[model samples]
Target chain A: MPPVLQIIDLKDSQATRSYLTKQTLRSWLLTTDHKRVGLLYLYTIIVFFAVAASAAAVMRLNLLTPRGDLVQAETYNKLFTMHGVLMVWFFLIPSIPSVLGNFLLPLMLGARDLAFPKLNLLSWYIFVFGGGIALYALLIGGVDTGWTFYTPYSSTYSNSHVALMAAGVFVAGFSSILTGLNFIVTTHKLRAPGLTWFRLRLFVWSLYATSVILVLATPVLAMTLTLMALERIWKVGVFDPALGGDPLLFQHLFWFYSHPAVYIMILPGMGVVSELIAAFSRKRVFGYTFVAFSSLAIALLGFLVWGHHMFVSSQSVFAGVIFSFLSFLVAIPSAIKVFNWTATLYRGSISLDTPMLYAIGFIGLFTIGGMTGLFLATLAVDVHVHDTYFVIAHFHYIMVGGMVMAFMGGLHFWWPKISGRMYPELLGKMTAIVTFLGFNLTFFPQFILGYLGMPRRYHAYPEQFQVYNVLSTAGASILGLGYVLPLCYLIWSCCYGKPAGNNPWGAKGFEWETTSPPPSENFEKPPVQTEEAYAYPVPSSEPITE
Target chain B: MNARAILYEQFSDLEQQRESSLAGIWAFIASEIMFFGGLFLAFTVYRLNYTQAFNEASQHLNLVLATLNTAVLLTSALTMALAAASNKMGWKYSTLLLLMVTTLLGALFLAIKGIEYIEDWHKGLFPGSAFAWTGSDPGHVQLFFVLYFLMTGFHALHLMIGMGLILVMLLLTWKGWINSRHFMPLDVTSIYWHFVDLVWIFLFPLLYLLGAKI
Candidate 1:
């Protein structure tokens, strides 16, 4: 006998469930089922979305007039800080990956469930427990550390709820780590027979890349936040410059996780877009190898360029120059991905459905987002424009405009399968159009505001910045409308939308090869892959299940 | 059916699963290395900046106690490995004993850690605005203590978790549930226990040896 015992002897969760389901509270609370766990994450993230969106609303109200008419500088500071904290930490990062990824990864991989399902649900509890403490912090008061939680300020200066929020973030880090662990183990051990690595749907590859980042990067963030909490509660001399600690060290620690974190946000959407582009365009993904490896390249190259955020933090000049260079290098694979995606659409049977519209919107916005990133990557320009609205515009272009678009596209695309119901395609397209228009209207003006030298995180602005701020605030209203529309229809669709046929889009992935609204167990028998992912020239007339 | 073929059929799946899991665990451990690796690099850089102070500070670290803890931790790791091995060999009694010993050693390690924290408290090495120390470089001496607390405290947390896991393993072993065939529990616990040991193996020398030139 070999010396090592197998580490994963997960009990059939149904046994645990049947026992728990006998007790109602235990059924819901003690449930270790991945699907139930996903629902918990979905519910919690929705709460986070509401909380963060409210902050955004307040921010827009304050910006209604250029100068601060509603909230004080301190209050304004808290709003923006909370907005960023809730969105990045609570919603955007975990939205698709944690909830949907947890739900789908095992199913798509043809497994019994994730390698560690209890860990999956435990991750959700950690997230919500963390969110509770953070919400309590907001209720009592708030932290002024900014979402970045920049040190010394977070440790010494801010009083609202730094410890509580940092503790929340610290706790949430475990969730990310567990999710990543579950995904990594699942992808490694759980594939159906004949489902090789290259045969993986691009979405699977995206989640795989995302899971890697989650495992590798999140622990650093956890430690950073732990150190911050210690400093706040105990007055530790770790980041406090009064005691000879370097504030710059904290920046290094925080950004190391947060930057790669942005990839965690986008990689899944990139996965979604890949499926979207392929299905709608009726093509095998052009340059499939390049596109897949490009995802991996982006995840890897992502770690090298975190220093770009610190150029103006007075890091060594040589370091700044090097970061600028490496930042440019990171863009190459991202550019290659975009090119490959656009190439996939060249002269195919293109369908401009709701999901496809969002995908196209993603291409345009992400291109702008990405190109502006290049502008920021140059030392000379970045030094001039660091912490300006240009930076704001640059990220919003990618984050809200690109990732959120792709997320919505994926949601619309998969809603049929997930709910066994199809949404009104017309309404989804209208929402897509309004979102794009509002998004551009909101952020496009901010680029000029940045160029004209308006700083971010300020409650009031000078007369010159007024016009842009007003336009931006107006755009937020429309953007808010766009967001609410989907919540309405998606919920409606769950109950009343028409029953979707299997292979509704005639897409060829293992996921769609299964039934719409797949059984409690994912498959009757493992799916056999006789062809490549997104295989073309398989007549559109043929069913995806064939 | 003969026991050998039954075992053979079971062994192949277990072996493949083990190889894949070990690869995954090693990958995870490498990331952990990079995680703590960043902190160690920071400690190195800061120590380089204040070698004399760091040297003086190292004298205050209880080397004998640290040495004792290291031995205890490494032994726990050995027990953890034995538990995994014996599980695979169908040595049920041996698996439970190894698990119990591993858990016991983990408790001893934490007890030593508590004593060390008490000693540091007596020495005024705890970090705070009011903290005071008599090392050559006050600034970096405090810096040294910051690292000391962070690294050791983080290590203690890991030990606590390893202890919890061993307890869980002991429970499963008690139920006569764990065995050679379905031993994922042993493997996972071993990975975690070894990780905690590996962290200390690095920490002991960093905190107690290098930079001690005073």
Candidate 2:
């Protein structure tokens, strides 16, 4: 009766098994399986994380003395630049979405895989190729321009590898775009029967929002960087002031992508925390619709406030005022997420498990980060502390304290599902706590030093700022330990830790309904989602069964 | 239809597979729009700042050749549409013929564009040190040519990619891989081709015709 006959190959999937069983390098290198691709991203980004963190470590240690002891001024500039570029593009942007989203999206949606599985694999290849090019730039001679790649200096004067690094980011930008495209199409066309928009998990909602931002915003960065690279190579007047070009134009175009890029960095972490909150608290998210729409709202409103970053760049006063107001408005959606997450936690079965501990850390630190963001959004206040350490401290809180916390928590929460083994629960909890303390120690003093007018991007500072810098350096060592422990034990758990069954935490989601590692086609049969996501506190009389 | 013949493992049925491909291509198109949108924004700002110089630069572009190329490209779109329609009707030979015709038309457009580029190069319309503009506001005029080359160069790159894809589709069609029962790849390729065509449609009026009368 249908126009075209449709057939379901039931027998083919009857033999479905673990995707990880194929243990050849070639299988992984050429595989289109989403789960394997997810692992590929996981392994790749971890390498990037270590490199970027090491750069941060060296910089923090160098800041310990007022005399800029560790590296030259030029070298320090390159260190921070490399740190920001590698971490933002290589690690944070791809962390949750590429690894966890690639793994869980299909499982949650009850689809076999993403809409374009080959595109997913291709994105990973492009990511690695681009990352290789970028790291190669660092190995040869590094670009001194910060990740912002502001013009005139970068376009006309900088002697370092600006064009090469821009080329790397440009290539990687396509990877981000493709990944976003895959997620958006998968969410749209691949949902299982009975899974409506409102019925999807909060994590999926957040990724969808993140994907929209990725799809729309990243290409502008690609084009902007292309122009920047071209200008550098050709010595054109595009961003060079000497040839009658305006530098502000570069800032405008850069922030247009970069500001939304800030959201691209954080929204998935918010998604992960939403899942952590619901799983730990044993309750439905209090305002599910509000939380869902707020993700979309953040993605949309993020575009309008890019001008906030251009406030002190000699933009018009009226434009600054508009950008300032728009920047404040983003807090509405962000606060909605924080408040809704907290409300979901209130009076519930609160367990301070490792994932939940990281989730709690996310809430506190993100609140601090978000609140400080308001201070920077205030026009006069920003003028006073524009490029100061306070600004550095503010973003580090959001990026490191907030997003990194959420990333760790999500990794812990999904560890059982991801690896089919439990990470040592006690060790996990301790790392989460240490990371929290170390993060505060590391960044909290910078807020004070910033308010005291010590600028960023400087290797040396006044003696009054030395005490805080020392504390921050001490904290960096501890934080490094916190990061390293999980890397060691998570690998150990994969081989030797007790085998975790499908639903370790009694987590309520379609992903939990399958085998621990999940089959190549995700589910044995297409799952029909009948209840809404986070249908928590199911009566104890009826147990959840695999 | 052989159930396993055309369907990918990830999809349950043919309809879902086709729908997914359609949705995926449209999403890619939306991204491409934003990609070009940035270049267009640059053009708008600079044109607003240096109107007379931009007008002077615009005059240097070979309008007759560009107009001929536009016609050639628009005809290629028509032939591309016919190829898709012929494949749908299961007319194998006409599909192949129309595809070849479309590819040729696209080649002709590129040829005209190449000729124009050569003409511009002879005139020293290139943006760097060899630029030979003696007009007032030479700096901004040089800026105009810089954008002119970047925008058109990027467009040509995309068009080349489109042609490569179509060539592959042509091969696939000859091998009976993209027949009526499984034409999603060809359909999506046409979508991309049209998107590139559509971008040129906008680029034509904005770049080549800006202040032509004034």
Candidate 3:
């Protein structure tokens, strides 16, 4: 038996106690437990997701007709802006990191909690406070500057609550900073005795890389937004071209942070898919060192490519060429990751599990998303497609198709460990299939619409584009159902699902060695790793049953 | 000292706890560098674009008060270092005395900064649309003042946070919550104080000294 099996005999009452039960409301409100904190983030982001999705639903409903039909132009503007702000800052950025990273970083490292658990709780409070202010801004009179808050319009013209919205995002940026700080310190100092750096799991590696970006990039966003808020409040000429300030300067500063902020949104999803691919393939990740290094490469190269977002914003031609080339260079690492994941499944025993389905879907969709990104990187092509549905469709493919799929896959993969219950596998697989189909249906048409010269962010469009918009609306409804189904079933499984024993999928990692729904301090005694990560046995022709 | 060391459940022992605390603060300082780094980047970009305007704007600053404030902040950093050293030696009374001096010096710097701000307001050098300055490239000069006030304002906020942290450390030290062996709190706070000072070190040259000779 493994050293982990030896600790199975050391289990006591504490080992069986679930983190969810037997905790007072006040205890949960003030808890410093990382697991509880992760749950807190989980519950909170889901609510934000619902609000943003409803805004999306309203937009899709209004877009059904070529003429303005559903709501006024102003309301439509606010809808998209509200969707972008809430989705980007409140949902997608924090989705995986605060939820899965918070819950699993300590467990995977064989540590009891993050390096500073109290700071972890404080990070959550900060997120809520920031989110609260943003939500209040939305409720009173929404800002229509879009999420980018591009200057001139945001600073001088827009009459909405720009300051409140900026303040909300500014304060929320620190929560991300604090969480990243916690993970960096935890990963550096809290590993088990025998767990060497190379022995670390891919998920942990990805989280570490994500943390680096979060630490470095978020503060830039904070500062940029601060400048934006100040400019709006004081009518400063910092970004106002009328007052000798260059608007391109605003674009430079904004994309300097916002572009890397995209990676911040997706890198954790890449990490989650890494874990899912390995577990389902019953093999170690092929080219582990190359795959691990690719993450850092993406993070570092991610910083250089922010200039690409400014290609059409009056940026100089030579600068555009340099940024375009750097953008292509960043794509190399993402391709490296995709190819490595495919090689890991070669001749290996691949299980068509729910998580594996989502992982495979992520590979296909992200490739399409990433390839379209290359087209956008080309200066000539981007000038044609900039500010069109093409840009919208391209990012949605990456953010929604790529990141959201991986998030679902990971949540399902780890749900048993998290909730100590089995969420009917057939239902899980169905959810994955529906989401993949619905996602493609929703975004694939937007590409065609964009190519045919349909501009984005407008309340209405020409009559010829009505069919594609109708198709998109149809796909969005299906996608909304796809999302709602999982949310319902996952919550149901928390209470009514069958009990999940330790190592339900027989996955190889320090996390699975502990009991499902791990105790308050993560482990009864700290686990010491005795073998390499993903040390599954070689495949036999006869399928092995659980 | 060994028996008195307070170890959290996450760490295996007090030594590991101390190492983690130090690493955590260093990571935080790295992020802080990036936070201030953004403003510096903006300053460099605008300075390169509008060189004469930035220099003329720099001439308007109260260099005497800024220079004095810089010295005061540097002296506080010295006292902060001495306090950490005293805490390491378990010299509680000396640590308290050094901390008090550091806090007083920090307050003095803020006082000097307040006087400078009042002087600027009287001169109508603030970034609003008010009419007072008769200088070349008034628009770009306003840009310079915007950056000057924003950078210094944030620095003052960080100093206030440092003061709060020092007060907490002082309370903890007096209540026997921290000792020589368990002085990681003091160590981390001093590192943070030094970082605040280091940002001003960069700020002093960039804001006050950069366009002085020009």
- Judged by DockQ cut-offs, the docking class of candidate 2 is medium
TM-score of chain A of each: 0.93, 0.96, 0.96
Weakest ten-residue segment in model 2 chain A by summed lDDT: A1-10
The 10 consecutive residues of candidate 3 chain A with the worst lDDT sum are A6-15
TM-score of each: 0.92, 0.96, 0.97
Q: Which residue pairs collide in model 3, if any?
A: none
Tens digit of per-residue lDDT, candidate 3, span B130-200: 63679778889989999999999999999999999999999888876877888999999999999999999
Tens digits of per-residue lDDT, candidate 3, A383-420, equal 99999999999999999998899889989999998988
> Model 2 segments beyond 4 Å from truth?
A1-16, A538-546, B1-5
Across residues A227-326, which tens digit of lDDT does each residue of candidate 2 receive? 9888888877887878878889999999999999999999999999999999999988989999999999999999999988877999999999999999
Residue A231 in candidate 2, Cα distance off native in Å: 0.8
Query: lDDT, candidate 3, residue A127?
Result: 98
Chain A TM-score of candidate 2 vs. true chain A? 0.96
lDDT string for model 2 (B7-83, tens) is 88888888988988998898899999999999999999999988888998898888888888889899899989989
User: Candidate 3 regions off by >4 Å?
Assistant: A1-16, A540-546, B1-3, B129-131
